[model samples]
Target: MDIHALKRQGMTISEIARRTGHDRKTVRRYLNGDRVPGVRKRAEPDPFDAFVDYVTARLNEDPHLWVVTLLDELEPLGYAGSYQSLTRQIRLRGLRPACTACAHVTQRPNAIIEHPPGEETQFDWLELPDAPTGWGFPTKRAYLLVGSLAHSGVWRGVLSPSMDVPHLLAAMTTLLALLGGVTRVWRFDRMATVLNPVTRDLTPMFAGFAKHHGVQPVVCRPRSGNRKGVVEKNNHTAAQRWWRALPDGLTLEQAQASVDAFARRQDERPRRTETGNTTAKAMFAAERLRPLPPVVFPVVVAEERTATRQALIDWRGNRYSVPPELAAAKVVVQQRLGADTIDIATTSGTVVARHRVVEPGLGVTIRDTGHVAALEAIAMASAPPGRPHRRKERIPPGPAALRAAQVLTGTGQPVSTVISLAAYEQAAKNRNTLR
Candidate 1:
């Protein structure tokens, strides 16, 4: 009879173990409702044992008798069990609500692949706001060119101007120097500067840069980011790591140094993807940096000059005081913008004094050394001989036409153009007057 009762409940040995607080092995020995010594034979006495008859009688009457109402009624009758205990007993009584089981479980499949050493690296450009370097003129926030290796997880980055041609060249040169050499193949997005816009081809600009550095440039397909997925992922990762290292209100150079140090540390980290491996190990063993050039880059200087009495005579924003012999003549002004250097020349190409452009509008006037020497020679030669007398003044034009002529001369355009513009202006003014 007990076996029949247990079988009707569908109580498995494991469930018996959990419910009765006995080991599964012990419950299994008592399986098939076999009674074992020292083990309770039947259902344990419930604390609500005394109320069971009354509760069962009410449930039989309605089958839907609320557990809470049943507990409330039993309370006055000296019932001591809590609501939870009565609920568990109700579940054991086979009156618990049934729920539909889920049809299937959904899960995401792993998509990561392992790469060998010296395989590939992802490249990207990250722009930051201009920074305050201690230089007198504010050096603006620039870009940091970044590259990350797929196998080793090593990262390289360098600061540069906008990701234009010149800046890109400088950045590539800097990165090659940092990494000890270039990689076999570099993967990056199809940036317009590097790829041909019309054809969507990566064969031209990248080819040139790659040839120079002895590496291959491979661009990710348009709208397909996962082709260069490693670098795209690393780009975000490196940004997070490097952004925090940027100095607050600091110079670009300072922020760059901070990023470099952080990158070095990141490279030293043991790879989470590869068990017991680090970036430094793979890069040092498999990667090699390009050799440095014998000579460093040259520094260019700039200058500013203003036009002179000799219409063309100017140097670095200063008027070259040409001799009276050449006054009202045209010459040439040459200046170097990178440094404080300037040169002046005649229309015939005679070289003049090369001097630095000075600050202030007119305070520090530069007297051309050659012009001064010519003046001194003239004065000395004239001091010994008697000077010529002054000539008489000429007659002026009549006032009636002179005033109108003065207005016409001050108009500056060719007289015909000025007359035409004035006529148009007067006609417009007359129409307004009519209105």
Candidate 2:
């Protein structure tokens, strides 16, 4: 506009070109009001143009046909192009439907997270869909305690029956051992088992567990699970990739084994890192993890119960028998996380009984054979005496014994029953004399 204004003041095109450092033709175009810039077309033709129709048709057919697959088909037809170039052209032409949700989510600015090896680990609980435990049991929901190393994306997971403190701690211990070590920081969401959501404080049990592992416990912000997005994303990955097709009827131990195997397989796959593509197992090798403690944090859960007079202790709606002597005594039942056995001990820490934990709602009774025998013996020993013990059948008295009894009564003499030969002889002699 300034140049045109100068030109309107009767300046020649040559003078305007010299004054504005513009080309003579540019000056004339501006002066003549031909200001709209001409669109510059590409001088070279696109190599993908010839294959556009084919690509579009293929996309229309499947919508999700891999670009690589399409590239493979095109390569045979002399569509010489790099995969990147082919994808760029396909995207530019909008041949594929745009993933709106994905675009919306990925378009949001996200911080690029970086961590040194063994610096941080993110953990979360994934609730799996209800499935039968393969033990002829009703369908039950399982939880996966998933943990991922932030630096290497090495993941470890264990299936748990519940999300209680003991299960959570036990799962963490197992995952850390599988991961080969612990990280400097352990990250978690505001799960009640891990932290007090309102106070943002670690739960007492988890605090102790963290202390035992020598790792600092960090809780994510409320409602912001993405703070620990590494494990959170791995949770979805595990569920979709592994848990989706998990065989039915898996016991808890079997499910845990399956999860471990899945994690191992995942770690074997190549992952993209800042350095380049590498397997998690390979990267984990370089991680400077903290050595595991000599012993794992105790994940044993305990409950106190009073044994009934029948020597039965009730737990989780099932009865487990203790020693008969423990009847009407207070006992403690300790069940270690991930352990099948339940231990019943006296208040003084004497293990009186041990039985395999039964599934809920089974109405099962776990009675130790020794305990049962002890109870039977105690019952037999305390039975009253002088009572006629009933036999399988009655044996009638002989006719001679009946007659001897009648004679004794007729003589009004005290009758003494004797089994000795001398007594029998004396009774026979007396009988004969009486006769």
Candidate 3:
């Protein structure tokens, strides 16, 4: 159209058409003011017009009814329209009502946090899918206790049989020891082992543990796992990147070792940080962690039990062997939090026995071979060497006489039989002669 004005300004029609890349006839028509823009006409009326009212009514009744379900209903009514046609018409008519609830809710923006070196560590539990146990059965529900240093993104994890207080503490201890030091602050979720769900206060045992480590326990707000986001992300990373490919038939010990190896590999990989691209191992080298205490916190649940005559102490329905000398002695069975072994100790804290803890209801007898050998020695030393004298033989009544006695007893009659000692001795001598 601009070429029309160009033609009026003394440019030839061929020149205008060639410059504008338009046909000469089109350019001439535009100059003559006879060309009109083409008008758009509607395509064939949609085949879905007959059922528009039905869909609109249903959507008005329940806006959430799926478009495919409407298609199913229309198909039975002899409507031969495809799903796309029906959805297109429905969308054009705005049949579905706007969901005000979802529209009003807004997502909160995530703030990037910068953790100073050795300042904090985040801890969380990751519940993994059922995996094959050492027994080759897919029955064990494994949970991994993950701890990550916030500054370095370096993490360590341990598999726990449970999320109870003992398991939690044991896993934490193992992870911290692997990391070689503790952070100033231990950030955690509202786990039952650490905080009371109802009161939202720290548990007494966990408080003691925290105090012993010289760390401040900072609990995330209820339902706010993002507060401890490092370990939370690590949870997913470990499950997807490491646990997913774990070999079949992994024992608890093997799984733990695998987790440790995976953590080491992860630490060596390079990661992006605010400072620059660096490996977690590199950052960890610069971290100034608090020195570990001379002794680990005593995070054990203690129970008192008396050793059985067989020198076996019973705990949680399982028997653990102790020294034979400790038989019938009252001893304390101390199960460290999250530890797989139970310590059998005296009241004075001297450990006399240690056995791998067995699950309840197993009725297992965990015997130390040494204890068995010692007990056998003690038994051998106390037993007499030779056979004792045999008692004098005595002859008894025959089956017929015994039956008669039983019948008489059933009749409530007082039945008795007596024999002289000399007569019994003579009968016994006759039997021996026959033999």
Number of the top-ranking candidate, with lDDT as the measure: 3
Model 1: per-residue lDDT, tens digit, 1-435?
A: 433356369987666667777787766665644665665755676566687788777776666568998889999999888999889987777643332231121232536665566667677887665444331122465567887777666777886545765556557666766766556677778888778778876645456666665677887776656666666665676667667455566554555677787778776665554355454555556654445454323322222233444323433123446554555655455543234555666656675556666741333456666777776676577574565555875656888677678777885333453234888899999999999
User: What ranking of all candidate models by TM-score puts the best one first?
Assistant: 3, 2, 1
> Of the pair 1 and 2, which is ahead by TM-score?
2
125 in model 2: Cα distance from truth in Å? Answer: 0.4
> 258, model 3: CA deviation in Å?
0.8
TM-score for candidate 2, residues paired by index: 0.52
* Segments in model 2 whose C-alpha atoms lie over 4 Å from true places: 1-107, 133-139, 302-333, 336-342, 345-352, 355-369, 372-435
- Model 3 residue 275 lDDT? 69
Clashes of 3: 4
True lDDT of residue 392, candidate 1:
72
Task: Give the Å error, residue 424, model 2.
Answer: 64
C-alpha RMSD in Å of predicted model 2 compared with the true structure: 24.1
Off by over 4 Å in 3: 1-107, 135-139, 301-334, 337-435
Q: What's each prediction's TM-score?
A: 0.42, 0.52, 0.54
